[model samples]
Every structure is written in C-alpha cells, then in structure tokens.
Target: MEKTKYSLGYRNSYVLQQYRCLLSIFTGFIILLFISNTAFALATNPGAVCSNGFSQGSLTNADYTNLVSAVNTNNYVNILGNAGGSIPLQVKMTTVESSTNTVKSNFGVITTAGTSAINIQRTFPNISAYTDIIFDFRNALTSQPIYLTNVALSAFDIDYANSNGNTFDDFVEITGVTQAGSTISGTLQPITGSNIVFGQPPQGLQGLFTRTASDPNCTAKNLGTQCQGSVQFSQPVASVKVRYTNTGYLNSATNQEIDLRVDNYCYVPQYIFTGTVFDDNGGITAAQANATNDDITSSGSIYTNKPNYFNGVFNSPQESGISGSTVKLVNCANTATTYATQIVNTGSPIGQYQFSVPIATFNNNTNICLIEEYSGTAYPIRTTSDNKNTGFTTTTYLYSNNDFGRVIAANAALVLKKAQYINNCPNTLNYTDPSLNTANNGDPKTGFSTGSISNMTPGQCIAYRITATNRANIGINNFVMKDILQKQGVNGATVTSVLTNPPLSTTDYTISENPAIGVNGEIKTKSLTLTSRSKRDFYFNTKYGTTVDTQ
Candidate 1:
C-alpha cells in the first residue's frame, strides 16, 4: 500500500510540473506574437515609412538592353519609370573612351577606359522633386592605376529656349560615400581653372567635387572593388555630370586601363508642405466697427474700450506667430479623411509647421485643405481668419506660406441687476397681518415688482428679481449664471420657487440646481444662436425667518 501511494504521488507531481512548463511556453509565445504585431503596425504606418520616399532603380534585362542600345545610338536613354513616372532617369555618355569604354547589359553597367578623360551625364524628368541621388561605382580592372585625379561631379539646370543662357553656377557635389559598411569621408572643394561644362551650351552653374586617396575603396585597384556614394545639390538641378580628368595607369608600360563601372542609381523624392500659424492682431478698423456695430454701447455711447481687437488683416512684422496649435491636411471633399497632421513649432521660427507626404500620395489637381484647430487657452476670445478653413488644389512640389491667422473677437459686454419687491403682498385668506394690502398693491400674483423693499416683518414674504444681459454683437454659447441664496435672521430665509419671465426653452437654455453647492444655489445655462444680444430675468421668492442661523 505504501509503495502504491508513493508511485501515485510521484505521478501527480510530474503532471503538475509539465503543466507549468507548458503554461510558460504558451505565455512566451503570446508575448512574442504581440511584440511582432506592434512592430509591423509601426512599420506600415505611412508617416513612419514614407518621409523621403526613397526608391531604387528597378531595371529588367530587356530594360538594360534597351538602355545600352539607346546610349550607343543617341548617347542618352531614359530608364526607370518611378514616382508615378514623374522622375525618369536619362543617362548620356558624352565623352566615351572608344578604345576601352563599354556600356554592358549586366545591371546596365557602364565600364569606362582610363586612358583619357570621360564624362557621363544623368538627367531627370523632374529634378525639383528629387532631393538626393545615390549610385554605386567600382574599379574592376586588376592592374593598379594612378589615383583618379580631378574626379569631379557637377549638377546644373539648363534652359532649352535660351540656348546661351544656362544656369551652371549652382554647386552640386558628392556629399558622402559608403564602402564595406564604412564611410569614406572627404571635404568638397571648388573645381576651379576647369572650363569643362556638364551639358550643351548655356551652362547654369559650375559643379563641386571631392577627392581622397586615404579611403581604400577609392584607391583600391582590385577587381570587383565597389563603393556607394550620393550626390546632393544646393538647389534643384536638371542634370548631373561625372568626370574623371586623369585615369592613367600606375605602370605606363603595362597599357592596362582602369575599368570604372557605375551601377545601382537611385533618388529620394521629397514633397513637403510648410506653413505658419500666426496671430493677426492688426486691430479693428473704423470701417469694421461701423459695419459690425461692435463699437457702440447699450446706452447709445461709443465703446472704445478695446481699440486693437479684430481688424481682419494680417500684420507680419507687428504680429507674432501662434505656437502649439494643431494643423491637419485633409481631403477637401471629406475632411474626416486626414492625410497628415502636425503641431506648430514652439522654438525659433515659432508657429511654423511642415508635412511631408509620400510620392504620388496626392496627384496634381487633387483637392486638399489645411485646417488649423483653435486653442482656447492660447487665444481666448479670438476668431480664426476667413481663410482658415479654405481648401486648395494640389499643384506644386513645395507649398509654402499657407498660413492660418487668428484675431481677437469683438469685446464682451454683460450686465446683471437684482431688485426686490417694495409693495405689500396680496392675501385673500391666511393673512399674517392687516397692514398688508389684500388687493396686491405694487406686487402682482404672477410676477414681482422691480423695486427694493425694506423694514418688513419676520413673517412677511418678499420676492427678488435678477436680470442678465449680453450686449455684444456676437452671440455667446453655453453661458452659465449662478445665484446662491443667503441665510438671513435666526431661522433664515427659504426659497419657495423660481421662474423665468420668457419661459426657458428646452433647446435654447437649461436650468438646474448646483449640485456642488446643494439646493441653496441655482444655475442657468444658455445655448448659442437663439438668443443673440438678448436679456433674461429670473425671479425667486423667500419667506423671512425669526430665529437666528449661523449660515
């Protein structure tokens, strides 16, 4: 019996251990699954993945063959249809070394002869849309060559209409290069004393280039040596030029030429929208005041309290930008379909905001709108500019100065008055005293008189009237008014009932007891639109007490 019990106990313990192990494994798997899903969600988000819209050149074997044929026939060919075919690659072999330079089909590679200087030009259909150009190059020749000298890359924009007026003065140079997971660093120096122009007549600007022999990738003369680098332009350029002034062999007797192969060309396209949110505190003009009638008081007097409020104009120098405001880019037709959103910058150049969208996100002529949300704490009593909600069609690559303005609204005018009934209350029966009028002298049974009353007995009843008025031209919304009853004498005064003169509409206003202050306080709230420049009166009656009360 003891041996059987021990065996059963051991089996139960083993089962429990297995169950715990399975639970731990299942829990780990669930955690991993959640982590992977979160990462995928972030990666697929448009705002996270499409900032610059970098795309590589994807060319097929047929495309490469066509590129080679076009280069041989016309010395130029437009490859790769990327960015909705807006940016096409046009490669031209301007000065080719006939003896050794060969444009091959493999990866559409260009192998150049090192005997004489070579010039290659790459043009784009829309240069302005591209921000950076990247490509890979290598020296495939086995024999070492005298370091490539005066190796320059230039970028410039050309005007086809004016044959003699091309702009080549803009600086375009190789910014950085990467080789074997390392950076080849060098400083860009001006290519002076060289009369070499990139394209045809009318060169717009001179190009800049850099050279460094200390980098192994550039100095290596081994076969299959490679280096990846990028070219950046100070301004948009129509074409880029790669020139190798001297490619002489290291051993003059060998007659072995340096084979330079260039491939893997890519470009990053950037479409940015920039704007500012500013306070247009230009102030209200005399014409505006006359039209809106906001400068007049209730008593027929000229109201000049706020001279600089709303002027319906933007003053750039005098007025400053409003920071910490949210701005959104949405479809004009359906604003709920938001494309991007940004907050107004709070640092230097305050109130500036920018949004960058992916390539082909919005085609030309697409209706879009930039909406700025108002901040009550930042700009209290202010109204947005007329064009704040305006929409415009997408047309340009760089949209700038699409500003939103805010101006102070008209002055707020409010008035409040309280009055007590002075005359005696009417009584048909249960009269406290005979001095009171039985026919209701000044006070009516339905309403109370707007006069102060004094020297009344403890048992005498009295009524109070409160009036509120909004004199502003603009309507107010959700306006709340609170009245707290005070304790008088020993037993204190108790409010019997409350009433409004015009009868409060359920849609326009609401009346309720203040829960925070108990039943002693009453609150009235008014909605917007129905009561513009309106007045309201509230009446409540209370009986005088004889005993003393603390509160």
Candidate 2:
C-alpha cells in the first residue's frame, strides 16, 4: 500500500510539472503574438522623422574651420551649399572617421576648446512637421577615444518664441550615454532659464550634467578608440542650438579636451498635401438651394440632409466619393503651369489623393491651386476649397482635406401654342368675310380666341394669339418664339403688315417685326426670361392683302 501511494504521488508531481511547462510555453506565445500585432499596427503609423541622413562626406576639419570663419564674417553660411537657396548655417565642426567605419561617415564634433562648456548652433529649412531629431554621438579627448563621466547634452529650438523672449524657455537634455550601435539608455532631464546663448561667441550657458558615461567598444583604430550611441530629441524643434557641457574632466593644460562627436542627423520636411474628392448629391434646405451660390467654403460645415433628386451640397455617406478622377496642382495665378497631378484613389477610402513636392519645389512656389478635371459624365461642380498659400513667409507646411463637390443637372422643358383671329367686315359680291356672323372687331380682347380659323376673305384683318409655357421645375433664360405670316396654298391670304401692342403689365417680354424672304410680314418675340411653371401670351394683328378668295 505504501509503494502504490508513493508511485501515485510521484506521477501526480510529474503531471503538475508538465502543466507548468505548458503554461509557460503558452504565455510566451501570447506575449509574442501581442508584440507582433503591435508592430503590425505601428507599421501604418509612420514616424514623422525623415529617413534621409545628412552625411558630412569628405569634409576636413580645415574645411569646417574655414566655413566657420566665413560664417563669423558674414554672420551666417549655408552648410548645404546651394541646395535650398540660401539657408544660414551659423557654426559647425567636423571630424573624419576611418575609411572602413560603416556606422559613421564624417562626424560633426563639439569640444570644450579651453572652455568648460560649448554651444553649437546649426540652421536648416523648416522642420515643424517632425516630432523628433535623431543622431549618433560619442565621447573623445584630443582625438583619443575615452569614456567621460558627468556629461550632458541639451538642445534648444532657437527660432521658437516664448513669452519671455525669442528663445525657447525650456530645453531637452540627455545624459548617461552608452556605446555606439547600442540602444541609448539615459536619464532625460528638463532645464528652464532665460536668454539662452545659441549663436557665435558662445558663453554663459546653464545646465546640469547628471548622466553617467559608459565605456564604448572601439573599432576604428586609425580614428582612435571611441564609444558611440544615438540620441533622439524628446520634443519637436526647429533651427536647433545644441550645447554640450562636462563637469567631471577639465585638464586644458595637458590638451585632454572632452569632445562630443555627432553624426547621422535627420528630421522630417513639410512638403506633402492630401485630400479627397466626393460627389455632392445630398439635399439642402430651400433657402440654401435658392441662394445665389450653394457652394460650401472651407470654413463652412458639411451639409447633411436627405438626397436631392435635382442638385445639392456634398454630404458624406449619403453622397459617395468619386473615384478615378484626375486632380492637378497648379499655380493659382496661372493655371496653365501644372506642378503635380494625381488620380483619385480607387481602393478603400476612395477618392483620396496626395501630392509630395520637394523642398526646392515648395520654396519656389507661392500661391498654388488644386483643381479636379471634369469627366465626360461628371455632374456640375457645386463647391471648391482647393486654393492654398505656400509662401516662404507662411508657417503652415502640411496641408490636408482640400475637398471638392459636384451634383447632377436640373430638368427643364418648354411648350408653345398659337391661335389666329379675323376682322369684322360685311360680305362683298363674290367674297364673304369670316367676321360676318362673328363679333370680329380686330380687338385682341374681344375677337382673338385660342384656336385656328378658316373661310377668310381678302382685305380682312386677322390677329394671332401665341402662348408659351415653361413646364420644368427650374427657370429658363433667353426664351425665343418666331412666326412667318404667309401660307403655301394659292388661295391663302397674304399678310401685309403686323401691328403689335404693349405686353401685359403682369408679364415681361418684348416683340419685333421683320419682312420674310418672299412674304411681307414676319414677327418674332425678343429673348424672354421664364420662371418655373410660368406662361406668357404674345398678341399681334396682321392686315391681309387682296390676293385670294375665301376657303
């Protein structure tokens, strides 16, 4: 009994151990899955930092020294030479690495140079769209790699303004540096002060060195032993001024100077524009529809209502996006000169488009316009919000949501009706006037009816009452009606002259008379503007020539 109990206890213990091992494996799988999903999600959320690295290729220390002298003489110099016109570079220092060093090319070095602290300022184009600036840094003393203690690096946005003055009030500081190619592990400290020195003649800077230095693994023997690691700005900056200070090591007599070497500088540029195009078919209020211009401006809200069969402003979901449309970016003052063109997106989030221009392209342009070309079957345009200002003086960089709107055309129709009347006259020997038994006074108010008439005699007076009606829901402009007063038969009466009276005071219209090719009378109504479901009546009296008999 004791042996059986022992075997059962051992087997239970073994099963319990297996369960724990399985649980450990399952937990690790869950952790890996979570990590992978997070990475996948972040793939679409791109970092704002630009990927292009600024290399100080083949530049010697003498070259940088000469450049600094020139900058001091001229107050500023361009480090990029002539890439983006004339951006100012205040001062810089350079150190060439070994030819085989893959991690760094030529490094921008900042040293004490007989001072306990040093401030280095560098200027470039706008970097407002970026969130961080990353670069590699290392420590050395008189061109020899040596790990230094109590070192701190602080960055300031020189161009940024605060309530105190033009300089940024706060700055980001980095300490506790590690070797290069390794993850930067340090304590980030914030410093606050006034009148931060950033330009030439660096002096009187304020900051504390709290970072502990780690010995770097040296690889480049020709450039001396050095440890390196990267540092990233905690906040977005523009026209930066970096200050390096050390309190642990100070031996100017022995030429044991502490220098901070920096390379692989990067920041994002603001030169992209994005927007979407959609069809405008959602209904609007009667007041909005009747307004002179129904287009919604950029400052206006998105209109939302029932779908209108005729025309309306743009509404999302109710009116879908128009895919495959052509959008072009052109000069606002001169549309003939096109800068960029793209087709509206056809995939998910349809009708979206984007434009990415180079810094030089953006710098050269001032006022720009985004225009969507009309397609063969496209509806009429309803709204536009595509113009933008990209001047050098303007601070706005990244543009988005410059949308357009369009709607279907309105239905329209017109109808016309004509009638004639005869003059009152007694019957002659061989001819009888049609007005013998009828009350034909040649007065339009009493004699003219809304139908045709026959059995007319020569030298009789006739009148015509023509009516035109608009049968659409919209107004019609430039409505014209014409009539020739001679018939084709041999017995047909020929009109000699047409007399017209003033149109009714309720109606607005005009009349004109002219001779036909072979007839003596032709009457036409001047261009008339008609409202929706409106009608107008035109009247004229014609005197017939004595050339035919009664029929």
Candidate 3:
C-alpha cells in the first residue's frame, strides 16, 4: 500500500498558523491590493513630509521626517506617493493600428488616448458582475512608456455604438495606471464593457463571464466537463477614479503610443478578513459610506486620539499586500468609513495594527468596527472554454462565510454605570440641598463624570454600581466581569463594603468580593451565566477621602 499525505491552507483571520504564508501584491491606487500587486509597487508623496514614492524597498529618514511633519501639521499626505499628483497625465493611442477592413475613425477600435493632461473627468460605471475586475489591455502592449491618471469609465451600452454600428459603446475603465520598463501598475477595475453584442438579450450575455474553471457551474457545459478561467478586481474599491499623473511618450517615428497593454486577473473574491474596534468612534454613516461617488471629505486627521487596535490575517489564492488593502468601519448603523493601509504582520500576529481615530469627530462615542482584508484585481472579459479569460457574472459568484474570524482592537469596550446613593454634605452649617444627578454630579445620558460634591460627607452611604447588558441573541456561558475602582482626585475614595442589590445565588450566578490579584497585579475575573438581552446591576459602597489637608 502507498502512503498518502495532504496539506491545507486557511484564507481568513484570527488563527496563529495562517500567518506564515506572507503574500505581496501592489495595485497602483485602490485598497485591497495583494502579493502580485507589490511587484510594481510605487508610493508618491507630494508634501515636503515623507518621501514621494516607494515600492519593495526601505524608507529613508527623510520619509519618516516628512511623515512625522505631516502628522504634526494635521496634514496626512499619501506618504505612499501612489496617489495622483498636480494634473492628470494623459495619452492618446489605439489598442491596434487601423487595418484596411476596419476604418480607424468609424470602428472606434480605440479613441486616440487623450493627449496632454486633459482635465476631462469621466464617471465610473457600476458593474456588479465581478468583484476583482482587471483592466485587460489585450493585444495593446508596446515598448513606449504608458502613463495615466484619473481614468474614467462609462456604463455598458448594449445597443449603443459610436458613429459606426459595428462598435458597441460599452464603458471600460482602467484607472491610475503606471508603467516602468516591462512592469505595469494601477487599479484593475470591472467596468460596464462591450461584453454584450447586438441582437443579444441583455440578460443572455450577463452570465457569460461566470463560466470559469473556478466556477462550479462552469465545470460542465451542455454535457461535458470543462473548467474555464476568469478575472476580478482586487479588494473592495474605495473609488473607481484613478489617482495620479504622469507624461506619456509615443513611438518616435510613427508617433504611435508605446508600452500599452490591458492584461489583468481576478479571483473568487475571498481576500479580506474582519476585526472589531471594541468601541469604535466612527463618523461616516452606512448610507454615505456605501453610496456611489458620495465621498465624505471631512477636515481633521484620522490618527488623533485613536487608542484602539485590532488584529487579523489575510489569505489570497496567490498573494496580497501592497496597495488597496482597506478595512471598512461602521459605528453599528450610526456611521461608517474606510481606512486603507498596506498589509503588515505577514509573518507574525505581533504586528497587530493600530487605527487611531480622533475622539472629537467620532460619531456614537461607542461603536462596533467591521474589518475586512481585501486583496483582488480585474482581468479581461471573455467567453472561453478554458479558465483563461472567463469574464465572471453575478449569478455564479462564490460566497464564503467567515463570521468567527472577526477582529477587535485592544483596550476597547470600557463600560461604566451609575448607582444611586443617599447622601449629605460636608460642613453641614452652610450646605445646600444635595444636588444628585446634576451636570456637576452625573447626567443620565452621558453617564457620570465628577461625583456629587454636596453629597461628599463622612459616614454617608454612597453606592458605586455597575450595570451589565447582554446584546447578543444567544445566552452567554461563563460571562466574566472584572473592574478595578480608580483612585479619584488627590485623596480619592476607598472601597469599604461590597453587596448586591439582591445577593448572588449559586443556582444561577456567583460573585466574589476582593478577588485575588495575580503576581502581575491583574485582578481575578468573575464568572457567571448571562441570558440574552438581560441586564444586571451590582452596588457597593466606598468612603470618601479620609485625610483632608488645607487647600
């Protein structure tokens, strides 16, 4: 008998093992770039702070100095320099030279790539067929330098055509493209393209791209089994518009364009993972975050007062990490926003990330952050028997569920509640009524800040309380609640007694007083069962500053 062995790989987050397979992708502009992408990575910074460009290389002190300067000035520059510059670098060339049978002007084989940096802006088409849409420049490769910025794509035109009825006016967008020698860089986007031909039902050709080798439906067509290939745009795109500028040169003698190619690739769309911010203070709303062209351009920086950190790993079919790796955030339903970063911590979980969100602009001071590790690209739209060039469709989209792999930042989810206390004032001779629950004391909405000054008196009973609420639908097992009272002001209060409004019972839950502290001074945790949507309140008493000195 022969021995057999097998190996497996994971494509989500929160596991120790998967961190070993580090990938590098580098898409020019756009979050969710991956390994292959890093092959042509380039960063460009415009400000004096931070270096203007970077790739698979080291950062100079100048880069750090610039980055630090930008941070200090509240001016967050790209630092990556992958973003666009002063103007849109433009070029005008055709995918192919005009042949005798095909009239150059009428056929619309291609528009002379625009010459001079035309500030002409084009809208991004909404194509939901494929997530990793690659901008394929098939048969358009040349030796001339290719430069692009602010690529604009239109919607698919099924029945529409240019001056000639032969050429369909389908929109194809490949934004933020750059070329260095044989290396190509930019965003691979899925635009409404000329996939559909005339005399064809709109719905008929929509699913044509889905017949790829990766598609289970494509395993067999008619009666035989045939696996085809397809393309996808990497990661969840922040914008379809390209971000950069450059000058393009054409073939000298022919003056024809050079270094032109539209070849890209896409995957089944499982390149991202998620982690929560414990209590994130996100400001963008879901409607606004998810809306098309509805970008929220708020002033202020993203890294101020952000004390939260989250950790997770990413998995891709090939590799991912360079540009376009973004994490989407939602404050439950209150606000949503996206922060794009390069994939760090490829080799270890120790490289956990920190997302600094300013507390001032944070909506819903408390929030749940959604994390997704995105890595993808877009490729040619095709209807072929082999996996090569099988443009994908929505009907055949593959879905994977990774709910358990969610991530949350450290030092998040701090909760505090108030407990009523009957009180009297210090120096009763001239004391006024004990104003409880006042702005000076504690507001019901914002919780307690400063304790009641009038209520401060020796031997007066004060209740320090805590309220726990279970938000999940399912019951929690072995719920542990631990808290250490803070040292208030100069002298502060000291815990004198601990008691439950209703004493704890073993039948349902348990509570311990003065739980033992570990060698590291960490307090022991309390364990109990908490029912779904249930609430519990605990009360204890404390003595105010006993030693008073002249102020």
Candidate 4:
C-alpha cells in the first residue's frame, strides 16, 4: 500500500520560509522509510507477468529414433506407467511444437555454454515475502513471515505463460540441438499417455508440472510446505532468464543457495523408471538448527491474550525437519522435582520450533517456577534456578544453546511477592511489593501478590503468614516447604501450625519438627507427603527466637 503524504502551504512568508528546509528533509526521510518498510518487489507480484502467464516448458518434436535407440540399449522399462501390465513399446511418436520458454538471466549471465543452460549461483535480492514466510512458518509451528525482489518487474513477464510461442517457465526445457550442442530447434512432444511425471494429477496431464500459486500437484519433498511451490522468474535481459521459485511458503527463499555443477549433475530424471534411493528419516533436532529468529519481547501496549501462549524458541543445525517435545514447568522453591507440562510441536519451516502455554495456568503472586521453554534436542540450555538463589526474585526464561546459539523466549515476571506483615524489626527494615493484589483465584493473570518471610527478634513469638504459589502453567509433584531455627542467627520462626494448603502444588507436606520442637530446635525438611500429588501452596506459622533462621 502506498502511503499518502499531505502537502502543507503555510502561505505565511515567515512560517513558509522557516519550515521549507525542514519539510524537504522530512519528506525525503518519510519516503525512505516507506520504501524500506514496504520493500515493494516485482518478483513476488503476480500482476507484472506477461500474456501467456508463467508457463511450464514442454518437449516439442520428439525424435523417437534416438530415444528408441537409447531405450533399446538400456532395456530398463519395467517400472513406470505400468497401468495395463504393458505399454505399446513401438508406438509412433509425433511432434507437438511445445512452448519455447527461453530464460534470460538477471544475476548477470550473458549466455549458457553453446546450448543455453543457466547455472544457478549467488544471491538475488531477497523477496520480502521470504522473510514474511519465515515468520509464518514460525508462528504456524508455534502458531504461524517476507523477502521482496524486483527482478521480475518490467522484464520477465510475471504473468507470462507464453512468449511469441516462446513463453518462459520452470521446466529446464532445452532445445535447438542435441544434449551435446546446439543446432536446429528440435520438436518433441510433451510426454503423454504412457509417459509418467512425478508430480502430476494424471487426469489431463500431457506435459510437465507447471508451478503456480494454485496448482495442487505442485510439490517438492522436504522443501517448505512441499505442495505449495510456485515458479519465479528473474530476467533482467532478453537472451537468458533464471527461474527458481517460491518454494511455497509465501516467499521463494532467503539464501539457501544452490549451485548446480555441470559434470556432477546426477539428478537428471528418465522416463519409464523411478524409485526413491535415499529417504530422510531423521529429524532436524533443536540441537541441529540455527538460532530461531522468533523473539518474545513485550511487543505492544497490551500483551497478546488469545490463548496467551508462552512461546519458546530453539535452533537446529540439521536440515531434516522437526519433531515434538515436552517442557516441564517446575516450582523454584519446591525441594521436590514437581512440575506441570506443555507439549511443544516442531515448527513449520522444518527446523524451527515454538512452544506455548494456554496462559491460564498461573494462579497467584507466589507462582514462581523455572522451566526450559526449549523442549527439543538439547542445544545445551542456559538458565538460572527458579527463584533458588538468595535474594533472587525475577522469573527468567531459560535460554539454552547447544553450541553458543541464542533464542528469544517469552518470559513473564513470575510474581512471588514475599513481605513480612508483622512489624517485628526497625521501620526501615520492612518491605512489601506495593503492586501485589490482596488475593487470587488462579485464572489467567499477569500480576499477583504473596506475603513474605520476615525478620524477627529474639523470643519474639512471630506469626509467619506464608502463602506461596507456582504460577506457571505446569504442575509439580511432592513439593517441600522447609523452615528452620538456629541459636546464633536471628531467632528462627517455627512453623507455628498447619493451615490450608492454599496454592495446592505445595500441600500434603509432613510437618515434623527437628528434635521434637526445642530439644535444640530444627525442622526436618517440612516436605509434602505421598498423597499430595499436585498441591501448589505453602502455609505455616513460625516462632522467632534462634540466631539462624531459614527456609
């Protein structure tokens, strides 16, 4: 879409003179930004094509004599097109004078050997559609991106299926001679009836598969969205045109360069026989992918609320596509290896992957947990403990890499607001998170409030109101909430008594006091018991009197 610019004429000599210079610079800047953001390109535009529309090259004037001789010498016609047990081997052949689609190179090649075969090498200006397609692939796997180019602009008809009987398309149809050199343009008919092609519907197929935006049979195994391929032409000159394609994920390709060597060209297909030789069986594990380009940065005034997904990204180094994996969201404070889970599927562009949570699992401010969003083959994840270290509060999205790669993960601050309510210390020593709410009901939320473990004086029978929660989407098992007392440190707050297991993932703990409460007071791992499977709560009182008090 073209942006509209308004012209302002002050008609006041003073004001007009003052802002004219500034207006000129501002206009130029706006034009530059518009061009950069839009990245208008002709290669991806469907309207710039010629009369015949991008065509599929066909074989014209087929000389059966040479082909018959080659077939007799080979004798390998036992496989393809085996409809009625056998095909008439000696059938007469005719010439159809197939379209002479000539390619004119855009990346600067004047000619091709003696016969005109364009060797693909180097980068064409990127189609913004390619980047757009990349993002689409990311979000599609996680949910569902463009690269733009102008090579097909006024030169190669973006819509041309025919040329003065010489329209250009995707088929590498070579003519004007034998396989060795050029001569008179040969006329061989497109393979029909008994002739078989890999990607055709077979109903009315009299030729090769012509790539288009709507061709259902357009497919290239292992490429992006296999069946969505489309032919793209880059012809800046008249004599030679180069056509690769939109591999069919909306854009053609980024820089996945392909170089076809002359002597080593081994993928030439022969009619009458076809079979798979090497099938890709392995997956593009996250450890094998490049760093994913998806970021989870806080993007707008309000975060996305649709099935609020916590997207995780990872990279893969291999190219075989991806597989599904699992991530465990475990509570940071729980001593037990308790956690909930979310399934992360393999991404759309093959190697990239996206992980998401329904955004409805977090309950309260006490909901602080740590888990790796990346749940594929390990790139060696890098993350800190979930609120495990001393004085640590911020919930971190673990970003791990197998070999020093990076990925952006959507990390929300898991609110574990802890503050001592009782005025047991100096006024300046007390603190509470001002943003925490008074309560929570465990729906989908962003911020929450949770009271803390506070300071106490010697023999200051302090009542510890502990309400902890694991706010992430996953759940954990057998969480432990421990507290202890020592002689030298600030008097420890004893677990005064048992109350409701508020959060649930923190319940059913066997509250046993060390030495039976004051025979040298210490608590033996106030851990949850066997029955409590997914309790996410913590509640107990404490009498402060010892030098060393901790949880």
lDDT of 2 by residue, 1-551 (tens): 99999999999999999999999999999999775444222011011123352211112344344443543242332244221311122223322222221222122333222211122322211211111122222211111122222222333222122232222212222322233423333322222221222221112223322222222212221122111122433332222323332221221111011123222123233355667777654544323442222222223532322223223234566656677578887877888788888988888778877786645564476777787875636555344434444333334445666666654443113456555666643222111234422333443334555444566676566656676765433456777677766643524634343332222122333423443222344566667787754667775555555343222
How does each model score on TM-score?
0.34, 0.32, 0.25, 0.25
lDDT of 3 at 354: 31
lDDT of each: 0.40, 0.40, 0.26, 0.26
| Candidate 3: worst-modelled 10 consecutive residues by lDDT | 249-258
Pitting candidate 2 against candidate 3, the one with the higher lDDT is 2
User: RMSD of each candidate?
Assistant: 24.8, 24.1, 28.8, 28.0
Task: Please count the clashing residue pairs in each candidate, in the order shown.
Answer: 15, 4, 75, 94
Give candidate 3's whole-model lDDT: 0.26
2 versus 4: better lDDT goes to: 2
Please list the residue runs of candidate 2 whose C-alpha ends up more than 4 Å from where it truly belongs after superposition. Answer: 1-268, 283-313, 376-393, 409-551
Worst window of 10 by summed lDDT in candidate 1: 247-256
Worst 10 residues of 2 by lDDT: 123-132
Off by over 4 Å in 3: 1-414, 423-458, 468-479, 484-509, 512-525, 528-536, 541-551
Which pairs clash (backbone N, Cα, C closer than 3 Å) in model 2? 176-211, 179-228, 180-228, 180-229
Top TM-score: which candidate number? 1
What tens digits encode model 1's per-residue C-alpha lDDT throughout 1-551? 89999999999999999999999999999999775444222011011111244543333334445544554354445444333432334543333322232322121333222211112332222222111223322211111111121122322221111123221111232333332233332222222322222221122222231122222222112211112222232232233334322111111111111222222233454345677777654443323433234323355534443323333233566656777588888777787878788888889778888876754665552677788886656454443442343344333345667777654343334455555553233332222233432323454332344433545565454555555665444444556655554554215544222231223334534544232212233445454331545566554444443243322
